[model samples]
Target: MGSSRQCFQRFLEQKNIVTNLLGKLEENTGVYYLPTGSIAFLAFCLIFGYGASLLCNLIGFIYPAYASIKAIESPNKDDDTIWLTYWVVYSIFGLAEFFSDIFLFWFPFYYAGKCAFLLWCMLPVACNGSQILYHCPIHPIFLRQQASMDSLVTDLSGQALDTAASLTREATKAGMTHLQKNK
Candidate 1:
């Protein structure tokens, strides 16, 4: 048994497969330096195995709730705006997830997939969820609407100014004629 276990370990190390897999998992979950055969790893496995729903609830409900309350109390305009935008985008994501679940729930690794997606969305690193949604869709739409509104305002203001100038010229001519008649 000992010899076979040693051989398996050697094979895993030689291929570097286990190490790479663990590294990727740690990168996504933010749980690093957890040895595979250690008690902590076993505990993590057990908790996640049975308490995945609970974990999802905490992440989905607790964090957002806390962040929203904190955002309201925050004095920094930029920070508040960032938090509010996150919530708006996240809400849209939630709606998409709801529709996706009808098909995705049939998969064996649905929960794991969902957790990975949520992590990607929330992670502050490059190509993260919030950044993708904001830059790809939300920001562009806002920019287009703002540009259209600005053009409309400019056109309306120009027309108003021209009308005012025409009225002023007519009023001045009438005043001069009245003065001449009085003389």
Candidate 2:
């Protein structure tokens, strides 16, 4: 708890883009101060029964996608690698979630927990979840399965091409038959 608070404080202290944007909005809105309405809205989303899933999904998708585009545009390869790692981790999580969401959504605070997790995974810190996950279990597992995965993918691609060719031939034959009958 203490470390998390410290990390959040440090994040705020940095006055990064998110904070600066929020601060600017608060200044212009003039309804509430920094973090107050933000915290309230967050808490409301977590506790309320509405829009939580949308919020969580948006958080998981939008920022990382924007960052990925930025990474692609920039000259540095480091951010590119980082964004790629993030996408890898996110894809894995999405696959796991697909099977588990039926049960997972039963929990009251599931969306909130997921939002926090996505934030953790998206954090710019060295110890972020995406980096840790990509380095450890994910990398090891991929290394072990890469050969089999490659073989499977190659087989599937060949089969797909074969099926596509067969379909095209059948369609052309039908078209020729129809044209002859029409004449």
Candidate 3:
């Protein structure tokens, strides 16, 4: 905890991040975007995303949207490998849930596996739920990339870190006299 806080303080002092653009809204307005209300859960809800992930799985039940992926041939295959991979991973996750339902029948073995799978499937959504709230106009299904909390923090905080790094480095170096001595 101390180290993490120290790092954050370093982040602040070094200004490796600029503004807290976390809540700042971009000016783009379009159908692809979700409102801010949904993203805020990112600041708090890791469990909620599991429910969202379950919903994500439901999206599979839909006749797979024949999304015309860019740089890929059209009508190449309605059921592309990418979609197949998604289905496979999610199915394993769903199977975990299914097994869990019958877990009571098997006690520790089924329950343990079920719990593990349930967590595996749901944790990403709950932790990274913020990404769901922000729809880039280009992502295939908005929040469909199976992003996790680390990825979300990177997406959310990476920009700030970049901005802060530049600003902080320049600020710290502004008073450097070694270069002046050489001159």
Per lDDT, the best of the predicted structures is: 2
What tens digits encode model 3's per-residue C-alpha lDDT throughout 1-183? 999567545543442112123213333433223333443453223233434434434334432332214214556663354444434555654575677655543343333333334334322233322222222322455356547756987887989999999998887787576677778
How well is each residue in 27-130 modelled by candidate 2, as lDDT tens digits? Answer: 89875456656867876887685889888888889889988998999999999999899999999999999999999989988888888888889999778999
Give the CA lDDT, 0 to 100, for residue 107 in model 1.
Answer: 71
Off by over 4 Å in 3: 1-34, 41-73, 101-183
lDDT of each: 0.66, 0.87, 0.43
Output the TM-score of candidate 2: 0.88
lDDT by residue (1-183, candidate 1, tens digit) is 999578546644553434566667778878655434443443454345667655654555555566567668878676566556667677787788788868865676555656556655655345667778888998888788998889999999999999999999999999999999999
The worst-scoring run of ten residues by lDDT in candidate 2 lies at: 31-40
* Rank by TM-score (best first): 2, 1, 3
Clashes of 2: 0
- Model 1, global lDDT: 0.66
Model 1 pairs whose backbones collide = none
Number of clashes in every candidate structure? 0, 0, 8
Question: TM-score, each model?
Answer: 0.46, 0.88, 0.26
